[model samples]
Target chain A: MSHPNRLNINVENLAIGYKDRVICQNIDLKLASGELCAIVGVNGVGKSTLVRTLGNLQPKMNGEIQIAGENLGAFNMDQLAKILSVVLTEQPASKNLRVQELIALGRQPYTNWIGTLTQEDKRYIQTNLKAFLLEDLKQRKCHELSDGQLQRVLIARAAAQDTPVVLLDEPTTHLDLYHKVQILKMLQQLAHQSKKTIVFTTHEIDLAIQLCDKILILDGKTNPFGTPSDLIKQKHFEQLFPSDMVQFDSSSGSFKVKK
Target chain B: MGSQRSYSFVFAIIVLALLLAFLLNVSSGSVNIPFTAVLSGMFGGHMEVESWNYILWNYRMPKAFSSILVGGGLSLSGLLMQTLFRNPLAGPFVLGISSGASLGAALLLMGTSMITGFTVMPFLNDVSLVIAASLGSFLVLLVVLLVANRIKDTMALLIIGLMFGSITSAIVSVLAYFTTAENLQRFVFWSFGSVGNLSSRQVALMGAIVGLGVLLSIVSIKRLNAFLLGENYAQSLGISLKRSRLTIIIATGILAGGVTAFAGPIAFVGLAVPHLTRQIFDTMEHRILIPAVFLYGAILMLLCDVIAQLPNSANILPINAITSLVGAPVVIWLLVRKRKMLF
Candidate 1:
């Protein structure tokens, strides 16, 4: 859409945590526009926390996180909202909303005080509804949708916001394997076609390696960041977990269960 | 998601229901005032019976207006709280506004006599009672707001409000134990919660307060909708949590507190009206819920008032009892039929 390689996010030695306790540090990332990236790690390795910090949803404990050369903390919430949209995993349940209505909420940043959707705003919602294949379920209440459908509604809502960047926490946690690939592929399409910088935290390391343009592995130590093949070449995934339980297969770019 | 019918159509139905309920409420009182008399008396036409005209203007009109303001304000605040807390069970009184009013009324009716050992309070009247209740609710709301500022968690604030309720209720109980039987009986009667007994001036004041509260809520539609998804997402979507949350809490306080001040803690209507409105509208959008609840609450209050009046009889039931009796069953029936609560 815009110049594809323009850097959208830059994080250097970023430390993220709640209050004084730092959860993840020495985290480094530089995501250009039109990139789909994943942060994959062991449980409690602060994958979600780092994503939250990057989204500016919470305060960072240390280091610098900049979006397009501006400090993450420099922008007020309104400005930040225009720049980034989030689909949090722990997002409180709002099953009462209809699919169309939830998607329409993505246009809130540009709407009037009463949140009246403009023609352009309505256009964005329609585009997202179609793009995400949610047109058929647009009239259905979100409670009626399966987990895969609901995640689509939430991501479409973020895309409808038309922000430059989107951060999602575990977008495919509850979906089946096929749905997981479907969502990842849609996200890949969104990044390449719409030129939005997309980042998500996920436990799907295999999918992340296969589909994501880049992957950040938080091993509770190095927290390596690079191209998936580069990280694989660097042996970053080998030490990701207890080798006694699961072994990292570098050639195949996936982890295998130990027998 | 929107209702299949146009909002205009739904609004027309709501307006018709409101008018019918208002007329039914006005006509069926202790005295059997005919519908024709109500219409003539309200309009430019002359009433054949002079006393009927006086009753219409002086009593029924003021009482009916009180019902609308009290009902509408309380229900609107209930919707606000439900959205703010993101909890289905949350309502206007969850913040201790009503308990504060009860404490204020109790202190005036019985605590004064208990402390001074004087059997009479010469300055006591309906106006003073209202002032006392207003002061009490205002004080508790102030404390709650201050605490809310310091605490980031909403459930914690709810617990604090409940603690305030427990504290005020305990004080009221102590006053009840110490006061004489006459003072206690007066306190009990005041606690019954009437939409009558308010003078024209008092009703006007209540109307102004409810109007201001409604206007504040109307402008807050964006924040209300954001809050439906809970605070984190709301914050992400450009809502400054501290500022938005405070304004909503203050609006709810003015509404629930002002209504409780005038009407003495009317029950079940606040807790049930939003849920009922959702059943009909089948949407979470505040643009619709605010007006829908306002209309439904007014109509329900008017109907409950008519039943409480116990037409053509000297005896009257407490409005608090009538609201609970009518509201509780409908909610039960709705839940039973759906086999699920509207989340």
Candidate 2:
């Protein structure tokens, strides 16, 4: 068990949605340092809304979100950015930006007003580039990258940001199975080695079960969050989807189509 | 390393083109001043032909300078707008700022005569035309800023800007319908766009205002680069979206409004130069693109102005027509070659 003081993110009695409507309420979750947590749900179950609210990209209707024991709303953009970095699913507006340039943007919070990278900043960027195995793609424009390559670059950018907590929304949306597993494994390694709290929302329940330290399940009735084995023992995956389409096999800890 | 070499090479070519175009603009007017006379006049040396000295200093110098300012200012504004809206097709005029200027100029040239029954107000002359245009553009800018605060969707804001443009154009058309033939002709000529009409004092004023806009752009380079990743990503990166958006709007208003006030809504430079710069330089970094676009825009405008002068002929083409004629083909070629949206 982790010490209570090591909690990186703590949400209590939260309700999240857009513009006067509430999607889910009575939500409580605590993420500790070095934990890789995955939020899994069926489509339209407010996984994105929940993730966005945590990232402070959307307004939370009613709740308390604490980052490092400080109120999430209290920190300004700059303060919040120092502690939390996010990688979103949206395509970049300009695909003509080079890979190195895109990665350098991670140093924006540390850069001067004119955005000139310092020697220390350049060193961090270079380290992240090597860590992510992106040395060969540094000169390539973002538009020239494959989906898996771009995903790695984005993750590398987040790593370069060097925040304690990193949030991602569907980081593996458009990749093949092998690439998807590769990205998840890389993220897991990042969380464990760097002692950063990595939280992301994904539809890959099987992969999340295999790799993530903990899982948050949003299934319309109740949002249950726990370790993958604990959630499986609690029959969380069985109620994830309608029985007509898929069935959870407790023995294999995976889901299968109903015949 | 290869990219750095290419960037320097492209910068050199653009600088060479700008200098050549500047010389061509100064020396190839109706009374062709020889290159030596233009050069001597520029350097403050004695000129053999007295009138050549007068023509180069008093007339062609201001015109050429205004062209450079207009070109640099308008293209930079366009680049800012494209980044702000995240739409490749967005130009400085997409916000209806120039149309608002047109409305103000139309009201002065035609509306006053109809309302007061005076053929022309002595005060409502060339200087006043610029003032009216500036006032009009700033008014539109304020309204757009107000709208921008309420709307988060850039596409929605773009549509609202178009609607504002439509409303202003409709009012201008009504004014045009009621005015006399002489007043209508004056309004039409103003709309035709000329870089050579302003005196040196007016050019200085335009330059000062556009310089402030350029300064704002330089200050906003970090925000602009963050914005290329889309608004949400930018926000998550700890960027204050509201502040960045407002800064971009004000900077664009100053650059586009200042140029339109003096240059009569010169088209295509704002709409096409950034695209051309991106194609030539092959990168989207604002730090590189801003200076590169400024130089390319100055060169393009000077080249267009030289062509419009028709060298040694008294009859000159309207600058608006020349820009479109040159700019439209480049845009078409870009479209045909890419066969897909660059954005």
lDDT of 1 by residue, A39-97 (tens): 99889989888888888878888888888668988998888888889998865446778
Report the lDDT tens digits of candidate 1 across residue range B1-343: 2223357787899999999999888888887788897898889689888899889888999999999988888888888877776666557567777888888888988988877889656888656776787678767767876776578576788898799889988898898898999999988876789999888998998888788789889988998888777677888789888888768877777788778777888877877899889878878888988999999999889988999999999788999999889777876886788776545
**lDDT, residue B280, model 2:** 81
Query: For every model in order, what is the iRMS?
Result: 2.2, 2.9
Question: For model 1, what is the alpha-carbon lDDT of residue A134?
Answer: 92
State the local distance difference test value for candidate 2.
Answer: 0.85
Could you tell me the fnat of model 1?
Answer: 0.59
Indicate the DockQ of the complex predicted as candidate 2: 0.54
* Model 2: per-residue Cα lDDT over A1-259, one tens digit each: 1233399999988889899988888778898888999999988888889889998898999989998778899999998877888888887777877888888888888888878788888888899889888999999988899999999989988888888889999998999999999999989998888888999999999999999999999875678989999999999899888799999988887889889
